[model samples]
Each structure stands twice: as C-alpha cells, then as structure tokens.
Target: MTYAEILSHIYALGRFGIKPGLERISRLMAALGDPQKNLPAVHVVGTNGKGSTASFLSSILTTAGYRTGLFTSPHLISFTERIRIDGREISEDSVVHLAQRVMAAAPPDTTFFEMITALAVLYFAEEGVDIAVFEAGMGGSRDATNILDGLLTVITPVALDHVEYLGADVPEIAAEKASICKPGTPLVSARQVSSAGEAIAAKAAGIGATLYRCGSDFDACWKAGKLEYRGVGVTLHEVVPGLHGRYQSCNAATALAAAEVLSGIGFPLERAALVGGVENASWPGRMEMFDGEPRILLDGAHNPAGAEALADALAEIPRGKLVMVIGVMADKDREPLLSALLPLADLVVTVSPALERALPAAELAESCRRQGAAVEIGGSVAGGVERARELAGADGLVVICGSLFTVGEARGHLLSRPFEAFRG
Candidate 1:
C-alpha cells in the first residue's frame, strides 16, 4: 500500500473508539514479531507532564550520544510529531513504510493507537536506537504501549482524568497507572496523593520492582529562578528547563531521576549532557510563546491541574490586560477549568476546536459567563484567537488555551505569517 493508502487504513481504526486493553495490542505486536521487546525503553505515564518528561528524557539521552526514539501521543501540530528520533519527526516515507508493514501484519481488527505503537517499536528496532522513550496515551495499565517491558518506568503526578475508563477517584486512577511497572524494573515517580502513593508502592513491591519516590528518594526545589535536583548522591543546580511553567521543574527533576536510575544500571549519562538537554528540550503547545509585541501565549491546559499551571504562568507576564481564547474537549471538567482561567482573564473568547469531541462554543461562553467574565462566542478556533488578538489592543497580551486541538489550530494560523506580523 502507498503512504496515503496506509494512513487511510490506519485512520480507519479510529472507528473502534479507544479500546483500553492489551489483548489486541499484544496479538498485533506478536504478529509483528513483538518488536517492542527488542528495543530498550523508558516508559512515561501520568495525568499530566508525561509529554514534557518524555521530551526531556529523550533530549538528555540523545545528548549523551544515544540514538533515541521518542513516541508520544495527541500531537499538537502534526501526526508526524507523535514519532521522532533525535528531535526530528518521522519522515513521511518512513511512516508509510512502517504503516504498510504493520497493516499487513496486524490482526483483522486493531485500534489506531495500537497500530501506531507497533509501528514505533518496529521503527526503533530498525534504527538500532540505544533507548526509546514511550509516553502512555492514557492510564498506564491497559495502555497499548504497556505491552513493552521497558528498562525504566516514570510516573509523573497522577490526577483525576479519563475517569470514565481509569476511575472516578485519584487512588483508582493511580492504580491503573501503577499497572505499567514490570518485575525488577526501576520505577520512579513524583509526589502523589498518600493513598495513591501507597497503592503504587504496594504494586511495585508486589512485582519485585525497585520503587523510587521523588520526595523521599529524590527531590527538587526552585530558587533564584533555577531548579535544583538531588538524587542518588548527585545534585544538579541552576537547571533551566526549556519548557516554561513552574510545574515543569518537577517534571524535569522526575526525568533526571529516571536518568540517574538508568545510569545506575550502567547507562552512564554525562552530567553536562543532562544539564544541556534540560536547557535545550522543547515541547510545543505548553506555554509556547509566539514572537510579537503583544506576545501570544499558547498552552494545552484542558484539565484543572493544567489550568492552574497556565494561570500561574500568566501571572508572571507583565501585560496591561489579558485576553484568553479557549476551547476544550467535551469530556473535560469544564467548570473547574473555567474557574482556573476566567479569574485570570480580562476578556474571554470561547470557540470550538475542529474535532468531533470539542465542546460547543456557545456552551463554553456560557460557562465563562457563569463565572462572571465578559465573554464572546467565536464559533471556531481561528475566529476565537483572532477575536482575542483584536480585544488585546496594542499593549495587551492574548493567551490561547484549553486544549491541544485549539493550540494546534492557532499554531497553524500563526505560522502562516512571519512571527513579527502577529505583533500589535
């Protein structure tokens, strides 16, 4: 099959509507000869910060002279962004080739993500990568990517998300993520709810895995505009992660901790490499700022925790006024998300992302209205961002957020012109 044909075939699997299980993935991978087992990997799972942590880890591993393969989900800009090697996206040619091979090997029925995961494993194996960093698409346990036995598993902060599939509470959700840990593998995690932490620890013990908790075994602190991380008798100070938001300090430290664990197992990453990687790593659609006089900030703050971080980041920018353009998926916690952002905005423009799951613009505006914010409905993401820019005037700032879908749309619109052109 041709590349277009391959993509069409893969996209057809979306009809299955996100099956959360390993049977299909396992069967599919087995048909593909279980390529995932041949590649050394670091699996990252969390409600938030998984992408950032995976990107940081990939950068550091690459800097340390390793051919690193990174597989992440829910791409902000392009589908190609989901797979990469050494910071470059998978070429169209490679995608087509892998898709064709996997399609031929896949079971008669397979989910889109499962097929994609299989393709990533195959590509990583073919490229002879020293390590691969895989981000869990949802909760860890039954996530298709969990089929692999990774060298290390990193869990970032777990929160109430995907409640329909994972659970309705934090502990239940944490249990699902903890399911990714394999026997004897090194597992690392950030600070979590006490009950959730206990659950994860119990699971680690049950599997005979070495569990490293952040606050207890390793820690990080921010001082003087720099992040300091201490773990395993090594300390890194004044480290600035390329990704913005104070929350990123925790994610960066988590990635560093995982690196230390890998090194302990003889992976051996240079200290300078770690520092440089953190300084240079970048994850788009998370507080990404476009160059302009009235700077436009874009973030994918779809949930309450993410919204809180976006609010904190907005507080640091010195703008005369803040105009927020937002869109969100229909299933997110809209009330809390609006509560986190509306209080930080001078004006709110609500819009619907170009996705079947997007919440209606009218409904979003009503939520902002209930929060007592001056709101307008913009129908679509482009319209919302444009309206926000107009409302911001010459010296004010325009912030676009709520979902990666919204940020991706805004990015495509903004990239059409030179960055200076967006300036007020």
Candidate 2:
C-alpha cells in the first residue's frame, strides 16, 4: 500500500468512533504478535503536561545514546507528528508499511486511535528502539496505549478533565490514570490533591510498584532565573526548558523523576543528557510565538486547566491591550475555557477552526459575550487572526488559542505569511 492509501485506510477506521476500552486494541496487538511487549517503554499519563513530559524524557534518552521513540496524540499539523524516532517523524514508507501490517491484523471495525497506537508500537519495535515514551491519549487503564508494560510510569498534574468518560471528581479521574501502573514498574507522580494522591498511592502499592511522589520523593523549584530539579540520585540547576509557561518546571521535574527511575532499572542516563534534553526539547502549539510585529502567540488551551495556564502566561506580557483570536472543539467545556480567557482579553475575535468538530464562530462569540468580553465573529481562523492583528495595532499582543486545531490553523496562516509584514 502507498502512503496515501495507508492514510485512507486509517481514516476509514474513524467510523468506529472512539472505543474507550482496551479489549479491541489488545486483540489487535495480539494478532500483530504483541509488538508492544518487545520494546521497553516509559508511560506518561495525566490530564495535562503528558505531551511535554514525554517529549522531554524521549529527548533525554536519545541524547544519552539510546534509540528513542516518542508517541503523542492530537497532532498539530500532520498525522506523522504522532510518532517519531530520535525527533524525526515517521516516514511515509514506514507509515504505509506499518498501516498495511496493522490493517491485516485488525478486526473489521477498529477505532482510528487504536490503529495508530498499534502502528507506533510496531514501528518502534521494528526500528529496535532502546526506549519508547508513550503518552496516554485519554484516561489511563482503558487507554489503548496502557496495554503495554512500562519500566517507568510518570503522572503529571491531574485535574478535572474528560468528565464525561473519566468522572466529574478529581479522585475518580486519578483512579482511572493510576490503572496504568504495573508490578515492579516504579511509578513517579506530581503532588496532587490529598484524596487523589492517596488513591494513586494505594494502586501502586497494590501492584508492588514503588511510588515516587513529587514534593516528597522529588521536587522542582523555579527561581533566580533558573529551574532547580532534585530527586533520588538526580540533581540539576539552572535548567531552562525549551517550552514556555511556568508550569513547565513541574513537567521537567516529572521527566527527571522518570529518568532517575529508569536509571535505577539499568537505563543509566547521564546528568549531561538530562540537562541537554530539558533545554533543547521542543513541542509546537503550546505558547508558540511567531516572528513579526504585533507578535502572534498560538496556544492549544482546549480545556479549562489549559486555559488557566494560558491566562497566567498572558499576564506577564506588557501589551497595550490583548486581542484574542479563539476557536474551540464543540464537545469541550466551553464555558469554563471562555471564562478563563475572556478576563484577559481587550477584545475577542471568535472563529471556526478547519475541523468538523469545531464549535461554530457564532456560538463561540456567544460564549465570549457571556463572559463579558467584547466579541466579534470571524468566518475562519485566518480572518480572526488578521482581525486580531489589525486591532492590536503595532505594539500590542495578538493571541490565538482555545484549541489545537485553532493553533494549527494559525500556524498554517503564519507559515504562509498571510499577514502584512511589519517594520519595527
């Protein structure tokens, strides 16, 4: 099969529509010879920071002379972005070959995410990767990727997310993520609510997994123009992560803890590799800035927690007035997301992203209005970004956020140089 044919076949799997259980993926992987079991893995799961943490860990392992495979979800630009080896995205040939193999193994009905997860494992194993970092696509336990055994399990900050699937309360959500822990696999986690932390600790103990809790077993501090990370047999100073947002310090810390645990398991990562990875790793569509006057900031703040982080980041910039161009998925917690962002905006330009699941521009405008922000509707993401730039004048800030799809659209606009060039 050709690359285009592979994509078409995988896209056709979307007809199954997001099966939230591991039975189908487990069966599919078994038929494919359980490729996931042949490779060592670091499983990263949480409501937020999983992608950044996974990227950091993968980069560190690669710098330490290990062949690393990184798997993430909800690609910003292309499907290939979901899988990578040593920072290079999966090639067309690799995608085609793997898709053909997986299609042969899968049942007549399979979800898109399941096929992709199986492909990632097969590709990583075939490439002989020394270590693979897998990010959970959604709630753990039932998540397709959780079917694999992990040498080190890292959980970033957990919050209220995926209420429809995971549960409305923090403890219920924490329990779902904790299901990824396996016996003899050391579990590392950030400090969470007391109830949530207890639930995770109990799960780890039940499975004979040593629990390494942040703030107790490991910690990170951001101060004096540096990020200080300290954990068992690991210490770093003045570390600067490539990603923005103060919350990244915690993500870096979680990665460090995972690295330390992996070292104990004989992976043996050097401190230099750890430092280099934190400083050099990059993940797009999270507080990504473009080069131009009336600077454009693109963030994928699709959930309430993410929106709050975006709001915090915006507070640090000294703009005359902030003009925001926003779009969001229809199924998201739109009210909470808009409430978090609208307070920081001087004016809001709502637009529809180029995705079938996008909330309509008029609906987004209504949400903004309800949040007490001056709002207008744009026909498309590009139009919204242009309008935001025009309203921000020469020295103001124009932020485009609310969804990864929105950020992707903004990136396409920026790359095409659709806006008028500015002279400083």
Candidate 3:
C-alpha cells in the first residue's frame, strides 16, 4: 500500500478506541513471532516526562555506541515521528512496509495504539537495535507496551490525569503506574506526593523489585549554575541539560540513574556518555519555544499537575504580558486544569483543534469566563495563534497549550509544515 492508504488503514483502527488490556497486543505479537521478546527494552511510564526521559536515555545509549530505538506517542506532526532510531524518525517507506506487516498479522479488533506498539517493537527487533526504550501510552498494568519485560523501569512523577480509565485519585493512579515494575527489575522514580510514594513503594516491595526514589535514593539539582546528578554508586557534576525549564533537571536525573543501572548490568557506558546524552536530548511540544517579535511557547500541559508545573516554570522566565492560546480534549478535567493557568494569562484565546475529541472554542471560553479570565474565542488552532500573536504584540509572550493536538496544530502553522491528516 501507498503511504496515504496505509495511514488510513491504521487510523481506521482508532475507532476501536482505547481497549486498555494487553490480550490483543500479546496475541498480535505472538503471531508476529514475538518481536518484543527478542529485543532488550527499558520501559518508561508516567503521567508526564516519559517522552523526555526516554529521549534522554536513548540519546545517552546512542552516544555510548549502542543502536538505540525510541518509541513515543502522539506525534506532533508526522505518524513516522512515533518511532525513531538514533533521533531520526522512521521513514515513510518504512512506515508503509511496517504497517502492512503489522496489519497482516494483527488479530481481530486491534486498536490503533496496539497496532502501533506492535509495529514499533517489530521494527526495532528487525533493525537489530542494542536497546529500545518503550514509553507507555497510558496506565501501566494493561498498557500495550507493558507486554515487554524491560531491563529496568523509570516512572516519572505520577499524578491524577486519566482519572476515568486509571483511577480518580493519586494513590489509585500511582498503583496503576507502579504495576509496570517487573520482579527483580530496578525501578527509578521521580519524587512523588506522600500518597503516590506510598502506593509505588508498596507495589515495588510486593514484587521484590528494588525501588530507587529520586529525592531519597539519589537526586539531581542545579547548584551555582551547573547540573549535578547523584545516582546509585555514581555522581556527575557540571552536567548540562539540553531541554528548557526547571522541571527537566529531575527528568535528566531519572534518566541518569536508569543509565547507571544499564551500565551496572554490563552496558559499558562511561561518564562522558551519561553527561553528553543529557546535554543533547530533545523532545518537541514540551516547553518548546519559537523566538520572534512575540515569543511563542508551546507546551502539552493538559492536566492540573502539568499546568502547575508550566506555571511555575513560566514564573521564573522574564517576559511581558502573557497571552494564552488554549484548547483541550472534551473528557479532561477542565476546571482545575484551567485554574492553574488562567491566573497567569493576561488574556486567553480559546481554540478547538481539528479532532473528534476536542472541546469547542466556545465551550472552553465559557469555562474561562467562569474563572473570571479575559477570554475570547479564536475558532480554530491557527486562528488562535494569529489572535494571540496580535494580542501579545512584540514584547509580550504567547503560550500555546492545554493539549498536544492544540500544540501540534500551532507548531505546524508556525513552522509552515504539513502534518498527516489523520491525527486521531
């Protein structure tokens, strides 16, 4: 099949929606000769920071002379962005070939995520990668990527985001994420709330997995303008993180610890590889900024916890009046998400991304109004960007956020790039 035909075939499976169990994926992998079991894997699961940590680790491994494959979700522009080796996106021809292979072997009622996960694992295995980092799509226990028995698991800060599918509270949500831990596998995690920490600790202990919490086991922080990372049996000073924002320091630390674990298990990484990897890692659509007369920052902060982090990061940067261009999914918890960001905005330009699940611009503006924010409907994502730039003027800052779909559209518009039509 051609690229367009193949993409349509895969996107059509999205109608099956999110079936969170691993049965279908497991069956599909088995039929494909179990490619997932053939490759060494590292699983990164959390509400946020999964992609960044995975990108950091992948970069580190690649720099250390290892063929590393990185699999992430919800590509900002192209479908090929979901799979990469050595920071290069999978080629369109590769996607077409892989999609055909996966479709031929897939079981009945395969969801989009399931098929995509299978395709990634197969591609990595066939390409003969030394290690592949798999970022979980959603909750851990039954997430499609959870089928792999990873060398180690890294959990970024667990928070309440997917309440309906995962759970309603932090503890319940943490438990679902903690289930990614395999027996005897090392688990490295970022500092969590008391409730989330307890749940993750309980799960790790029950499974006999060694747990390493960031703040307690080892930590990373900026002291005197240099990144310092302290991990199990290793310490690095003067580390430089490639990504922006204060929160990335924690993510770089988590990736460092995971890399240390791999080295301990005979991966042969040197101190230079660890430092260089963190310094070169890059993930788009998270704290991404485009500089111009009116600077535009694009972040995929759809939940309250993420919004709070973005707000804190914004507080440290020196910028003029803040104009927020926002859009979110229909099922998200809107009130708390908006509450964290609304106060930071001098004006809010609401928009609706071109997707089935997006909340209408008018509805989002109403919610912003209820919060007593200065809100206006910008109709579409592109319109929102234009209106926000006009309102922000030359010295002001324009922040586009609330959903990855929104950020993706704004990014495409700003960069003048064409993204795939089916972004479901």
Candidate 4:
C-alpha cells in the first residue's frame, strides 16, 4: 500500500469509534506476534501532561544512548508525528508497510486507536528499540496501551476530562488510571488532589507496587527564574525546558523520577544526560511559539484544568494585548474552560475544527458572550487565525487553543502545511 492508501484506510477505521477495551488490541498484538511482550516498556497515563511527561522520558533515554521509542497521540502536524525513535519520525514507507500488515492481520472490529497502538509496538520491536513509552488514549484499565506490562508506570496528575468514559470526577478517573499499576512495578505520579491521591495510593499498595508521589517522594518547581527538580536521588538546578510553559517543571520532575526508576532497574542513565534531556525536550502544540511581528502561541488546553494551567502560564509570560483564537469539542465541559481563558483575552475568535465532534463556532461565540468576553465567530480554522492576527495587529499576541483538533488545524494554516487528519 502507498502512504495515501494506508492513511485513508486507517482513517476509515475511525468509524468503528472508540472501543474502550483491551481485548481487541491484545488479540491484535498477538496476531502481530506479540511485539509488545518482546520489549521493555514504560507507561504514562493521566488526564493531562501525559505527552509532556512521555516526551521528557523519551529525551532522557534517547540522550543516554538507549534506542528509545516514543509513541504519543493527537499529532500536531502529521499522523507520522505520533511514532518516533531517537527523535526521528517513522518514515512514510514504514507507515505504509505497517498499516498494510496490520490491516491484513487484525480483526475488522479493531478501533483506530487499538490498531495504531498495536502498530506502534510492532514497529518498536522491529526497529529494535531498547525501551518504549506509551501514552494512553483514555482510561488506563481498558485503554489499548494497558496491554503492555510496563516496568515503570508514570501517572501525571489526574483531572476531570473524558468524564463519560473514565467517570465523572477526579477520584473515579484516578481509579481508572491507577489500574495501570501492575503488581510490584514502580508507579510514579504528580501531586494529585486528595481524592485522586488516595485512590492511586490504595491501588498501588493493594498490588504491592511502590507509589512515588511528586510532592511527597519527589518534586519539581519553577521558581525565581529557574527550574529546580529534586528527584531520583539527584537535584537539577537552573534547568531550562525546550518547551514553553511554567507547568513543565512538574512534568520534567516526573520524567526524572521515571528515568531514575529505570536506572535502578539496571538501565544506566548518566546524570549529564538527565540534565541535558530535561532542558532539551520539546512537545508540539503545548504552548508552542511561532515568531513573527504578531507572535503566535498554540496550546491544546482542551479541558478546564488545562485551560487554568494555560492561563497561569500566559500570566507568567511578557506579551502585549492577548487575542485568542479558540475552538472546542462538543463533549467537553465548556463553561469552566471559557471562564478560565476568555477573561484573559482582549478579543476572542471562535472557530470549529474539521471534525464531527467539534462544537459550532457560533455556539462557542455565544458561550464567550455569556462569559462577557468579546468574540468573533470564524467558521473556518484558517479564517479564524487570520481574524485573530488582524485583531492582534503587529505588536499584540495571538493565542490559538482549546482542542488539539483545533490547534492541529490552526497550526497547519499558520505553517502553510496542515496535517492530514481524517477530514483532510
């Protein structure tokens, strides 16, 4: 199969929708000769910060001379962006080959995510990666990625997103994420709320998995113009992340702790590699900056907690009048996100991603009106960014955020080459 044909077939599998169970993936992996079982794995699961945390660990391992495979979701520019080894994206030819093989071998009922997860593991094994890190698509217990018995499990702070499938609150959601804690494995986590922490602790203890909490066992904080990470029996000072956002300090700390666990298990990670990796890690579409007269910032702050974090990060930056270009998914909790972001904006341009799940631009405009934030309804992603840039002028700042789908589209427009999603 050619790249286009492969991608078209994979996108068509989206119609099967999100089947939130591991049975199909487990079977699919077995059919692919159980590639996941042949490799060492690290699992990172959370409602937020999963990508950043995984990116950090991947960088650290890659810098330490290990053949590290990083698999993430919701690519910013391309489907090929989701799989990388030693920071190099999976080749288009490889994607075509893998997709064709999976298509031929997998069940017809396999969902998009399940097929992709199996493909990632198969590719990682074929590429002979020393280790791999997987970010779950949803709740860990049933998510396709959970089929791997990862040596180290990192859970970033659990929050209330994906409420319908993961449950309606933080604690319930944490329970589903905590299910990734295999017996006797080390589970490292960010400092979560009381309820979330309690659930994770209980699950870890019940299964005899050692639980390492950020605030309690290890910590990372951005303070006084520097990032300070103290974890894994080492302290990093004056660390600078390649990614933008003050919230990244916590993610860096989580990665450091996870790397330390891997080192403890006989994977040698040098102190110098740890320092350099944390400072050099980059994840796109999370506070990504594009330089110009009117600066562009793209962030996928799709949930209320993420929006609040984005707001705090924005407050810390020195920029002129903030103009926002926004779009959101229909099932998201919109009120809190609008409350968190709109007030920080001088002008808001509302748009919709080219996805069936996206909320209408006019509807989002009404929500912004309720929040007392001035907004313009831009029915197209490219049109919305243009309008926001016009509103921002030359000296003002334009922030594009809300959904990953929205950021992906806006990024394509600004960069002059969009990622081909299912719609494209």
Top candidate (TM-score): 4
Better of 1 and 4 by lDDT: 4
Between candidates 3 and 4, the one scoring higher on TM-score is 4
Clashing pairs in 2: none
**Number of clashes found in candidate 4:** 0
TM-score of each: 0.94, 0.93, 0.94, 0.95
lDDT of each residue in 1-424, candidate 1, tens digit only: 6766776677778777778899988888888888887788888998889999999999999889889999998876666788999999999799988888888888777888888999999999998988999998885778988888888999999987788998889888888888887788989998888988988898899889999998989888888878898876579989888998888888888888898899888689889988988888999888899867577998989888888998887777788789999888897778988989899888999999777788999998888898899998989887888888888887899899887778888887887621111100
lDDT of 3: 0.89
TM-score of candidate 4 relative to the true fold = 0.95
Stronger candidate by TM-score (2 vs 3): 3
RMSD of 1: 3.8
- Candidate 3: C-alpha RMSD after superposition: 2.0
Among all windows of 10 consecutive residues in model 4, the one with the lowest summed lDDT is 415-424
Q: How many backbone clashes does candidate 3 have?
A: 0
Q: How high is the CA lDDT of each candidate model?
A: 0.85, 0.84, 0.89, 0.88
Candidate 3 Cα outliers beyond 4 Å, as residue runs: 161-169, 421-424
> Which run of 10 residues does model 1 get worst, by summed lDDT?
415-424
Q: Give the candidate number with the greatest lDDT.
A: 3
Which of the predicted structures, 1 or 2, would earn the higher lDDT when compared with the native?
1
Model 3 lDDT per residue over 17-78, tens place: 88889889988999999988878999998887888889999999999999999999889978
Candidate 1 regions with alpha-carbon error over 4 angstroms: 417-424
Candidate 4 lDDT over residue span 86-109, tens digit each: 889999999988988888888879
